[model samples]
Target: MSGERSRTDRTTLLARNDLVFIDFDGTISVTDTGIAVIDALELDEAWEIEHQWRRGEIDSMECLTRQWGMVDLARGAVYRMIDSFELDEGFNELAEAAIQIGAGLVVVSDGLDFYVDRMLGRLGWETCPGEEVIKRPRRCIPRFANHGRVTDHGVEISFPHRSPDCDQCGNCKTAHLQRLRAHFSRVIYIGDGHSDLCAARFADLVFAKDALAEDFAQSGRPFVNFETLAEVNEVLLAPRTR
Candidate 1:
């Protein structure tokens, strides 16, 4: 079902008890971190697999598994490359406002935990210092994503959050939001890709961009179009009728 908008035009009322679910890849960062890692490692065949997934010929699990396998770079090398990634300049402002407002912030992604944790840590989102024993955070705004580990042979990819019922995605964002539904009165979602589709539908409010925006447009769901965190904060901080 589509969401009801707040009294203010083009704004939504987010309460203090609301929980915000954010997508990490293309949404927060300028580019898809997973795709950037794949490209950096010169995994040319991964593109073909991605195209197959987009064309509805392959599922997301297969696409991710095959793509990770094609990545032959050493664990250290991979981290070095990922460290160079850049985030949207306005993300910190949005984050600060959310924190100040006492809203829960969570990162839900279909990408690898290693990259997600690393990138978030670079932005000072770590749960605690020296707690990244496995090269991934204990929690990233209490995140959920595919787990990644460095092994003797190469990087091992595992999906602890993969839903057994849904074979389409490695991490079922819909399931994640469903679990959080009872804990918060309102759930807000921010995202920018195909993986964000299921979860975005369940959110009380959505801020979308790139492909996710197109998905929202086709779904006829009420959503805010945001190019930066500044725009997101503008809507988030807007006065509520209730």
Candidate 2:
């Protein structure tokens, strides 16, 4: 991190310093872990809620809140099921690249902190209460997202960083990115879903895939199309021609 550099010299400024924000659900993991849980449990009600959110009948916060009630299975059972899911093969490489470059990396996801924390822990990184993990270099990669608690009734969700102005996402990614922009000269966002659209707009650069790529295309927002963390690493860690 350094003094603010004018956006006019963005090519040079962004080359050396940037804060990278990544999404978890589909970006880091191969698929959405939450949906994987629903499928594993065969919770029909959860599917209906997801459909509602997709069809614009309800917001993501509402959809997730309601869906949690349908997950009546025990915590251990759900954890075992979700463990079958896989992470993006290049996540470690990307993380290591970010660390080497002295760039700030934060996994700002809308997914529940429970799975996020589990995944981070499995990657050998220590996590904090809010799923925050700092693997040396004196930079923070906190998992700013919703949280879930399993109980006898079902899973209960808490939106710790819900946006006061927007109800679309449980943990609004745009708000988190804006806060990061205050300190970082360039904000690089990577994502692959509807929940990431707003934050994508706020980012200086975006690596998008699936529905998110289409959203950026339709809206005429420039972004790099990528399907793997390898692609992201190649671009971010490459030598800047400018």
For model 1, the stretches where C-alpha displacement exceeds 4 angstroms are 1-13, 127-140, 238-242
Cα lDDT tens digits, model 2, 90-130, are: 77776666666667778877778878878866766544532
- Cα RMSDs of all predictions? 5.1, 5.4
The collision pairs in model 1 are none
**What C-alpha lDDT values do all the predictions have?**
0.75, 0.74
Compute each candidate's TM-score over C-alphas: 0.85, 0.85
Q: Per-residue error at 35 for model 2, in Å?
A: 1.2
lDDT of 1 at 178: 84
lDDT of 1: 0.75
Candidate 1 residue-wise lDDT at 98: 58
| Candidate 2 lDDT trough over 10 residues, lowest sum | 1-10
